[model samples]
Target: MLRRLLGSPAAVSGHLHRSLSTHCVSTNLRRSLSTAASSSSHPPWAIIDYNTLVDDSPSSWAPGACFDPLQPPRVSRISAPPHLLRPRERPGPGTNLVQLLTGHVTAASADGHLLLTYYDIIAEGPRASWNQTADMEVERFICNPISGQLLRLPYVSGSRKRICYHRMGLLTQPGPGGARFAVADIVSQRERVIDRFLPELGRWDMVVGLPCQPTPEREMDMNQETVAFGGRLWWVDLTCGTISLDPFSYRPELRFVHLPTGSTLTSHIHTKSESAEERDEVAKYRRVGVSEGRLRYVQTSLHEPFVLSSYVLDEEASSWALEHQVELKQVLADGGHECKNRPPQIAVLDPMNAHVVYITLGEQEHVVAVNIYQDKVIGSAPLQNRYHYLLPCVLPPSLGSSQFPETGKKGDMEAIDVLVSCGRHYKG
Candidate 1:
């Protein structure tokens, strides 16, 4: 029947014309899908760059997943900057330059609020006189990228400085009224004390009497990603394990959960010997996250015959049970790439899919999503830089623009009150 329709000269001409029109439309559509493509059509989950942002276009500042399904994941150069209420003013006609570095996404709440610290530097007069005229101010705040609401946090208790240098985590606890928010600070390196800043209270409360260090010899170093899971804030060390405590508790006790045996650096590597650079290299291959309603850990072997392994935490046994282990040689081959001597860094685990993981491969740092269960590469994207720290934020249907409630108004008051008390005027 199909052949009969095309057998006639008139029918053949009509079909060819339609095919040509369809091809043109598809070509134009592909051309329009650039980095600034409409984000409403993309998935909610995105690998957000910690320090990158596009300040000109306020709407595009929210990180939206941008990658072509047919092509390897391509880096979108114009990333959504953290939407700010008070943008910096342009430099005057004189030799003046105001540079703003958005800094890094230090931590994130499971609900999607990001804890960011940035520096605003202004230099006036002339290029040569920058040393004398430059003024830099540090700003730390939490914001919901989806909602575009930001709240600058008050200074640490009794500190004259505007920014706190300690490791911080965004805390969210669901309550009968609503989810209460706060920031948890590991106040001391040698002690288990924490300073939690409650927006409602408008002050930082010092939390003490927590458990001591898990390993007295191995000092606690929490420079890795902080995970908010199971009603506690987990401070992870890629080389060792995690120490977690509930910020909401009046008298919270710290608990230690070590990485699965053979997964971490040897017990004898003291804090002094294991430098920050060494710890960072270790983190490139290993990651711990909450996926599929379970705390999971993933590690890619540093040696040849490279292996990618995953384990899930068994709270009952206080250990990680092996879930999946697959050699990368076959996986890379399937992805139309070759396995190199060095394994790809583990980018992120799919918060919604238990079997999917993203790994950055090659010097170009193409991000490839592989399904460990199937041992196949599902998707790939190229990143602008290999050093970008990705923070995964899964936005569920329930998440909306009004995620910030009346409590945000109180937070604003707290910010102003602190500035007044310190005799410092609010910059913005």
Candidate 2:
């Protein structure tokens, strides 16, 4: 009966108006039958030759997945390399989008716009090798998702001054594009440590402030070590060695925490009698990132690639406790260089999403991107230039609108991009 429907090999091929490409026709038929049986309600095994049931037509796809049929086609390919679009691709009466040179970027959503944190954009002249002729400038790119436009805050307060801690990055969503971001800066003109706000709905506001502290010299470290989680800004203080940050509710709290050590993760592997020294060493840690108002970290003194440790913050008691410790080797596979570098800096790429992508510079100065979700090293690339990088942000999602809006778009997909930067190399 089965053979009767398909007819003979030559007859079936003729019916389909095509020749069989593979000799294993019987095996292919078996698999096709299995799939048809699995979803019998869909259709029958009408030997269509190829099994690519794709309708790339925008009309066949769901709404938002494609564009409206009434409007002209709104989709087209985005060309790169020789076609890598330059800013002012065609000079017109439009906004000057922030040009991201070789640097780190992390964008998240804030009030519906893309809050893009772009670090120091160093200048490198192709002809002169790498010689800078000007002072560094810190810039923040705020792109409105709806308009597909970006705004650059090149100078703070519209003056020649720069923003504090432009290296590490500003807070936003967790991806490779602009979302939204919040920053905390102390007023230099006025002696008040204040929290600045830039909500999706309106302008910046001084929402919070600290008592007082001695200001560092111009060249010294003045950046507030900040991370965004539970919806607010928080940081690790080197002077006090404690975390002072804002929660999702916009309240500030200070907590003491420590990172985990390789020794600790190893002891868990084997050993009934774990040494006291090993235990003591593992217990001591530093702030890494926070999750659900809980603090997380990794061992600082560790000279080798090890595990990532997170500590949960006990607000009532004002103390820290261990939460999760996943072996860094399990993900990194190769020994991480951040362990080789002295004071290691690592941050959970996105806390909202369980897929944590940690960014750290290794001994060879390779910036590694580790995936916490799949337990693997997703990306490892060398920094093009040199400047002690402070912040690296994972950008948020955006419209990434199709170039030819006049063309009704077809099947489009989502993607993630990363932003990172070294210090001020080209002063220009």
* Best of the candidates, TM-score: 1
Candidate 1 global CA lDDT score = 0.57
Model 2, which residues run further than 4 Å from truth?
Answer: 1-139, 144-148, 152-155, 161-183, 187-192, 195-225, 238-287, 290-295, 303-308, 315-317, 324-428
Model 2 scores a C-alpha lDDT of 0.31
Location of the lowest summed lDDT over 10 successive residues in candidate 1: 12-21
Tens digit of per-residue lDDT, candidate 2, span 130-240? 223322343444433222233444334543324343213244443333343454443331333343544332334453344322322211111223455445444443223
Model 1 per-residue lDDT tens digits across residues 40-122: 23344556554433233323222221121111233321112323323356567665475533345667788766776554445
Taken over the whole model, the C-alpha lDDT of each candidate is 0.57, 0.31
Q: Estimate each model's TM-score.
A: 0.74, 0.40
Give the lDDT of residue 128 in candidate 1. Answer: 41
Relative to the true structure, candidate 1 reaches a TM of: 0.74
